[model samples]
Structure formats: C-alpha cells, structure tokens
Target: SGAPGSRVLITTRNVNVSRTSGVSEANMYQLSCLSDEDSWSLFKQRAFSGKSSDDYPELVPIGWKIVRKCKGLPLAVKTMASLLFCEFNKDKWEDILRSELWELTEGKDKILPSLKLSYHHLPSHIKPCFAYCAIFGKGHVFDKDRLVEMWMAQDSITTTARQCKEDVGRRYFEDLLQRSFFQKSRYFDSFVMHDLIHDLAMFICSGDCCEVVDGKLSSTSRVRHLLCRNERDFRRLLSCGCTDDLLKSSRTCYCVGDSMEPDDVDGAFFMKAMEGMFMKMKYLRVLHFLCIPEITELPDSLGNLKHLRYLHIYASGLTTLPESVGNLLNLQTLRVETPELNGLPRRLKDLVHLRHLCITGDFLGLTDSMGNLHNLRTLEVQSDKLNDLPESL
Candidate 1:
C-alpha cells in the first residue's frame, strides 16, 4: 500500500498478533521490566514529588520493600509510591507494603492490581476525568492545559461559586500527575499514560466511551465519547447506520490524523468527510484535530456546534478559522498551532466566554477588540511577523 521500501511499525502486547501479521521472529522486539536502579529513581521522583530520598531516611527501607514487591514494574512501583505520597508515618508505609491488592495475580495483558488500587483511591470527582481519557489511544501524547480544558468542557471539574474552573482543573491535573496517572513524555510540555494505565482507563469507561481503530467500532449504542484514529476510521463512522443518533449523544470527538500517511486517503475525500461529519455532531463539547495536513480550512457548519467548549487544531495546514467560529457562545478554549495559518477571524474578538487562546503562525497581530474577552486567563502567541500587542490587550 505504500511506496517501495516503506515500513510500518506496530506495537502490541500479544505475540500472536505479530506472528499473524507475518512479522519475522528476528524482527520482533520484547520489552522487559525496568532495572532496579532505574525503578527506584522513578519511584523517588514520583513519591516525593522531587524531594530527596535521603531526607526521609527512616522511610527509605519501607519504600524499598514496597518497590521490591512491585517486581521492577514501573507502573506498579509508581502506583504504590503515589499511594505513599506525603505519608511520613512508618506504619502507613508498612500497611501499603502489605496490601492484599499486590497479592492478586496479574490479569489479562498483565493489568497489575496496583493500578486498580491507584484508581480506587482517586478522589470521587477525579475518577470520571481519568476514565474519560479512555477515548485516547495508547501512545497518545497529552498537553496538560489542553487536557484540563477538555475536562472543563465535559463538566468533570468541580468548583464552587468563588472558585474559577480553570484553577480547579489545574488542581485536578496536578493531582493526577502526582499520582502517576500521567507521566512526562519525551516531548517537552507533554504527558503520556502508560499502556497498562490506558488499558485500565478503557476498562473503567467501557460502558460509555468508545475508540475506533482500523475502521472498527468497539461500541455503538451507548457511546458518548469517540476517537477516530484516521481517515478510514472516520469513514467507517460516517457509514455506520447509527451515525446521526450516535453523533447527537457524543460529548467529545477526537479525529487524530497524526499517524496518517500521505497515501492513506485522498485529501479531498478526507475534507468532504470531515465537513459532513461536523454538521451532524450538534451537541459536541470538545473537538480536537491533530496533524491533519490536508485540512486547509474548517467547515462553516462548525459554528453550529452550540455546546462546544474546547477546540484544538495542531500541526495542521489550516490557514484561517471561519468567521462563524465566534458564534460558539460557550467556547472556553481555542488553540491553533499551524505555521501556515495567516490570521485570526475578526469575529474571534466576540468570543466573550473564551478563557484560553493560543495561536502560533504567521499572523502580524491581534484585533484591538481582544479587550472584549474579559474572562481570558491565558494568552500565548508565537509569530515571526508579530510586532506589538494590541492596546486593548
């Protein structure tokens, strides 16, 4: 399907899948557990949230005992360490050291019982937020602020009248980060969930969230959140008999083309599919597009998404946002990262409810009406053509 000498890389836990795919044994690779030294280093980094292990000499021995029980499994060690975070008492550490959860045999695909214990201990409000991440595929890199904004769009963050939702969302993100639910990615300012942790999230939200890969939908009737990994997956979604009703109930939809190759689908067909899909997802709260190089512009019908709160387009070929985008009265976050982009729509200044705006492109400057965005909390812009800030800002 690709040009001569092209290769496809596949990652999986099942050896049989690889063998069935015709991968030669000589080309196969197996990953082993972390070395004890590396495991301890990772554990200390998470458990103390950067505090030195020597400072808590008394707890060091108990920590090693807990780490040893983890069998050099990074996720297991981090889970147990996070559970012991901020606990100075020796008995508490010992209790976790002897938790019955560790005694349970590893389940299918090696879903460690320690991971389940970590999820069980998550705050009630944070549980759904974590589970909602099941919509993302394994190996997907996460943006901290973007993830929090999506949570706010879904009403996953709890806040009082005096508290700002953004603040609350940030707190929730930090809590998850500290608990090992998220780990830093090799890419700067990004995070990734361990494959095992991703599996746990999928298990937690199996009833409502669905992921479509290689044109296969896991669930249709009760699905509320959907992830379409490529053009084939999106096409499959459009051709599904229950599309209209399914789109109506969907709260979040992520169409990720980052993994797409140029030969995967014709550009025109992909755009046409996207335009048609947008018109049907009336109640969507969060919409994300990544590395969709064929997307030069968004459909005007995108503005019809009245309930949309978070919108992100990254590493795309987008040149301009439609003026109708301002019609999204509930939109809270808008991030566009594309060097090809020329400018923002003038009506963008009318989004009074917008809280975060990040743009990176060739734009010269912003419209003076930016002062109208009273609720704005974070503004980031990177442009070689930009000279000065608007007085209204």
Candidate 2:
C-alpha cells in the first residue's frame, strides 16, 4: 500500500478549502432537501406523534408545510421541533414559520441569540466573509473560491492574511456556520440564505448600515431579473443592461474535481427555485421562465392571494402538488402539463369559485368529490388516465 501521507480525506461544507498543497479528491457528495414524504413524516413524528387520531388528520398537513420550509436542515428541524412541543394549534406553527430569525431565537440566548450573538461568535478574521456576503443578493449563491478571494481582498482579511490567510478566513467562515448564520447549498460549494436569516441580514443592512451593506437590493438600484443556466448564462446575466424589476441568473459549471465546484447555484434545479414566486408575487403580473425546464412543485402560500387570476406551471417535472392549492378560490385560469401526476389533492373540491382548469397531460387519478364544484365552466385534463368521472359533475 502507498504511504498514508499521500492521501487524506477531509469533509467540509466549503469546497474551496478541500483543495490542498498538492492533492486531488474524488467521490464528493452533496445533499439536498428531503423528499416531501420524508419531510412530512419527520415533522409528524416529532410534532404530532402523541396526538389522538380523532384530533390529528386535520392538523397534520399544516405541520408538513413547516417542515418543508426548514429545507431538511437537521439543525433547523430539531431546534424548531423541540420548541413546537409547547404549542397546541396550527396558528402557533404559522407564528413560528412566519417569524424572523431574531423572533425565534430572541431572549432564548441560552438556546439561541440575536445577530450580535451570531456575529460575536465569528473569529476576528472571518467576520468579513459573512459580512462580505452582504454584497451578494439575498437568496443568491456564490462560488466558494471566488467569494473567498473577495473576502480576502477585504480590509479585514488583508490585515490578517499575511500571518495565515487561508486558516484565518476559513476559521471565521466555520464560526459563522457553527452559529447558524450561513447555510451550505449542496449542488456547488456555495452558501444560501434561508428566508428568516436572510430577513435578519436585510434588516441589518436596512438599519444603520444600509448604504454600507445590503443583503437585498434597495430602492436606490434598478430591479432586474437574471436567469442563468450555466457559467455562460451567468456571464449573459451580468452582460445584460441594468433595469428595474428582478434579476435572475442560473449557471452550470464543470470542474475536474470536487474542490473547485461552486455550491447552491444548481443550474439543473434553478427553475424549481423560481416556481413559487411565479404564482404569488401579484406585483409581478407578467412572468416568464420559458428559458428553462425541470420544475416540479408550487408554493401553497400562493392560494391565499386574492388578486391572482392567472397561473401557469407547464414544466415537465411538476408531478405533484400541495393540498393547500385548493384554497385558490380566486383563481380564474390554471394551466399545467405534467406527465406523472398521480392524483389531484382531495381539497381541490373546495375551489367552487374556479372558471378554467386546463391540465394537458396524464395523471393516475383525477376523480373524487372534487367534481362537486359546480362552478366549473371548463375542465380539461387528459381523459385516458381518468380513474372515474364524478357523478356530481
């Protein structure tokens, strides 16, 4: 056997740090959010296992939403899971879900702390990397080495890099990670913003340091939408002229080894990342993701929006849906094209105010009490796969 000194295996959320003085690594693994079934089951076990059958079926679904938002981060699930043990109704779960990072962790310093606490945990050198992210948009993912280079260029690191640059910045980044300030997105070695934590960053950037730092764009800058599906796509996003709307970008990069891969910004799944917004942001009356495909899910929160009249999710991967989707009482037109849809949510029966429902593909089951919605003027799903036509129709 070769000397053990020739190889060493180290695991870290950051890809940049994995590259060494003269060694290449293989078989790196990246993790994504849990499947809906697994997430729902996990939430049910910890949040509702003790409840009686007579009281659960109605409330269990709501718990599933909370788990989905946690994005399968065990740190987040367990922290909130234990806290949820004190509540009795769905409102409490919503309150927890709707809360900002500070709200959940406030006063519970023994349990969690405010940004000051999260910030305080960072070592002297790496504080800038966390703060440096303020330059990127909230929910934006960054290439690890590129970002680390920028962080090193910052005054904080240059002041310290001479002594031991890599270790200094890395230690700070790890500190921020330990304190739960930043999360690693699996596709590349990049970090992503969870909504609440991003809210915290935006809150900070909007406060005394608004001009100096912004985790999100401010009114001062023009809004633009950038959609990139590859590194060439990223270059395309940056190359476009500035505007005032939303700037979306997606990029797929190829690296010879794991150490060089960027995180979070998955070119393949970027469309799913944008699906929820397409349905909800009424301010965004006009939308488009025609450039790419591979999206599969929609955000259930969009159903509560009363002004929304037009919805479209015709992507190939959109095979399942949320039961909360039944609440779209105001929807006037719905369109989709998914080949593997197994069934419609039972709650679809509640949409009595609908006018047009157009699904042009196959589904395993499309019949149930849902046909009772007499208000339907047009229903156009594939007929071949229909398990049964509702007599009530």
Candidate 3:
C-alpha cells in the first residue's frame, strides 16, 4: 500500500516479525526504557502538574521510590503518575512504595503487572465497582454524574455516616480516578478507562458480574450487568428469541454505542421485543434505552421492579411515565427526554429515596407534595406551559 514516498512505520513487541518484514538492522529503531531521572521527571509532570518542588518536600522521596519500580517504562511511569495525581497524602504514597505488586514480574511485560498492583490494592467495596466497568466498550466516555448514579443503582457504593449515598458514590469515583483506573476524556466531566485497565476489569469480572451480548446471546443466569453494543446487535439477538432463564437476574441492561436510526428496522417489532425483554428482567436496577425514538411508552409492569434505582429514557417518544412508576420507592436517579410529556404523577413524592431527577417536557407545575421528596439532590425540569413555582421549591 506504500506509495513511492510513503513510509510505513510499524511498532510491535516481536523483533523477528520486523526482520521478516524486511526491516534491516539499519532501519530498526529500538526504544530503550527511561533512566531514573527521566522517569521521575515524567511522573512528576503528570502527578503534580501545577505544583512546585517546594510544595510537597516530604513526598519527593516516596515518589522516587514508586518511580524506581516503574523500571524506566514511560507507560508504567505515566500510569502510576496519573494514579497519584492530586494525591498528596504521605501514607498513601508510602503504601504504594511498600506494595508487593512491584515484585510480580521482572522484565518487558512489567507494565501490566505493575498496573495490576494498583488494582489489587483497591478497597473491598470498590473492587466490584471497578469490575462492573467491563460493561462499557473500549474508549467509551462516560458522564461522571450519571456514572455515579448508575453505580448507586447497582448498589456498588456504600453510604457512610458522614456522606449520603450519592456523595459516597462520588468518593468512590474519586478514589478510582486517583488510582489511574479512569482517564479524562476530551469532553468536560467525561472519562474513559484505559484499554489495559479495561482488560484488567474484564479479566476479573468475566462470567461473574458483567457480560456483553455481542454476536450471540449466551446463557446469562449469573450475569447481573449486561451490555449490548448497539441497537442493531440487540435486534439481531431478539430475532433469535431469548429464553426465560436468560438475563433473569440481570441488574443492569445497558444499550450502549449507536442507536437505531428511524429507517434501520421495523419500529413496532423492535418495541415489542424490547417490552418482552424488560418484562423478563424483573430484577433490573439500571436500565438505559439510548435514543430509541420508536419507544413511545414504557411497560406498566415497570412498577413491579421495586429494586429499580436508575432509569434513562434518552429517546424522544412517550409523553409521561406510567403512574405505577411511583411504586418504585427505591428509585434514586430518573432521566427522561420526552418532549411531549405533560405531567408527573402526584405520587412522585413517594419516591422518598430519589436523589436525581432530570426531565425535559411540557409539564404544567410541580405539586405541593414535591416538598415530601426530602432526599432529592438534583432536579431539572423544562417546560414552556408551566406558570407557578411551588413555594416548597
């Protein structure tokens, strides 16, 4: 494929392949690992981007010890650097320095093993939190706020006396963010787990908590977190039909990536299949129907899911949620984008545990009973027909 002036530069871990591909010794470029000084410089640049050496005099020695273990590999150094970013506590730095994960491997493949050390040191409460991330596809950027709410829905976060459940979830997210498990996306307040980190999560979570229904619908009795790459993949699986036992215990059903365009398939058939699937997933705590405009309404049986915590209706279809939805007292986060929606159930006040609510619609007014939602933390409503604002608001 190379033109007269076009040059192809290949990067690989195998040297024999490079030789066989006609790369002579003169053309071969071997990348050597960084030296101790260079490694520390790179690590420090990422970990304490804005801080001067005088800012944290005590952490320098500890940082050096941690950097030395990186074995001069930039990836290892950068990974650890990102892990320690904005972290200034002496004890945490010492803990990393003393961790035995540094001794897991000896040579070129040391980066993964070093990264695993960080994973191994995660708190018991956050272990499952990290593992559940396998549900997301590679390079998937997630909204931090929504992500925390989803984790709360999955019951992956534990509330402490000083912090509310949402606050606790945020703390967990920060901890993971500090440890290099997540990296910032180009978009604001969005993040992505590095591919290596994602691989580690999948390896730990496989066959236990997360499963992606791609190309096939394998038996999923034990899978609590499920993901479908796109609407097309889901439709293909639906045509084959699902068994009664498949995904029966699923707590999260995420339809990620691209949505189905209006002309992609039979809309009625797609909606019918989705309704049936939702009915079988009675234990679902987190459900996401990403931009499926054909879904005009949700199943009334949706109220039977007492465990439901987070629900997202990105599709612009049905106007209002079924009144039975109020029966989900455990719901924590609700996001809907039904522009035609007219009103919310007066019983919405009964969702005493709800924390976040976002809806864009043609609503009239908030009922006085809205004051009864003592736990509500975030509320966003858009409507042109609304006149009166509740005194309680």
**Model 2 poorest ten-residue lDDT run:** 250-259
Compared with the true structure, what per-residue lDDT tens digits does model 2 show for residues 1-393?
Answer: 577768555666566666643335555556676777776665555565456424656556666666666666565554345445535677776665565653454443233333343444345555545654554545566555444433443334544335655455566666565455667887567787555565555444333122211122233433222222233243233233323233221011111101112443454444443343333343321121222233355556546444434345544556666777676665544556566566677777777766557776666656668666775766777846667666767
Clashing residue pair totals per candidate (backbone < 3 A): 0, 21, 1
C-alpha lDDT of residue 25 in model 2: 57
| CA lDDT, every model vs. true structure | 0.83, 0.49, 0.79
Q: By lDDT, rank the candidates, best first.
A: 1, 3, 2
Task: Score candidate 2 by TM-score against the native.
Answer: 0.32
Report the lDDT tens digits of candidate 3 across residue range 1-90: 677898888987689989999999899999999999999999898788678756899999899988888889777788788777888988
Q: Comparing 2 and 3 by lDDT, which wins?
A: 3
TM-score-based ranking, best first? 3, 1, 2
Instruction: Rate residue 312 of model 3 by lDDT.
Output: 86
Candidate 3 CA-lDDT value: 0.79
Better of 1 and 3 by lDDT: 1
**Least accurate 10 contiguous residues by lDDT in model 1:** 234-243
